[model samples]
Target: MCVVGIMVGLLLLFAAPGVGSLSLGFLFLLGAWFCLWFFPHDLAHHVVGRVLGVGFRYYFLGRSAITN
Candidate 1:
């Protein structure tokens, strides 16, 4: 997520007129989503799960909840 944010910021700063900053931003967001989709065991989800008192399992590729 942080990497995606930084990439988006850089793209916005350097994106050409024809390339469109909005499109670049969207692409960056998409990439972030992809990262999360592929690696859902990230700290963000873990933190949220812990805060919500949910049982969570972190896999190498993704995370899953055991119970609500």
Candidate 2:
């Protein structure tokens, strides 16, 4: 789903023309990158943590999670 959204955005970005389209594509790409790269870790920290009964004290740059 996420990949699909990014692909569609890229297609529109290239198919359309103008500064506005470029900016939209750039922002979409940036957001997609973040979602694919960062969102999963953060999501796991919250979901898996609680599910496994592990308590997270905090997160470090999304690369790691500190637990209690």
Which candidate has the highest TM-score of all? 2
Q: Tell me the tens digit of each residue's lDDT in model 1 across 1-68.
A: 64565555555444433454777757765665555454444666677988999896644544555677
Residue 43, candidate 1: Cα error in Å is: 9.9
How does model 2 score by TM-score? 0.38
Give Cα distance to truth, residue 18, candidate 1, Å. Answer: 18
| Model 1: residues with Cα > 4 Å off, grouped in runs | 1-20, 41-68
TM-score for each model:
0.31, 0.38
Instruction: List model 2 lDDT by residue over 1-68, tens digit each.
Output: 44555466565445445435667767766665655564455565587779999977865553336577
Error of 1 at 60 (Å): 10
lDDT of candidate 2 at residue 67, scale 0 to 100: 71
Model 1 worst lDDT run, 10 consecutive residues = 9-18
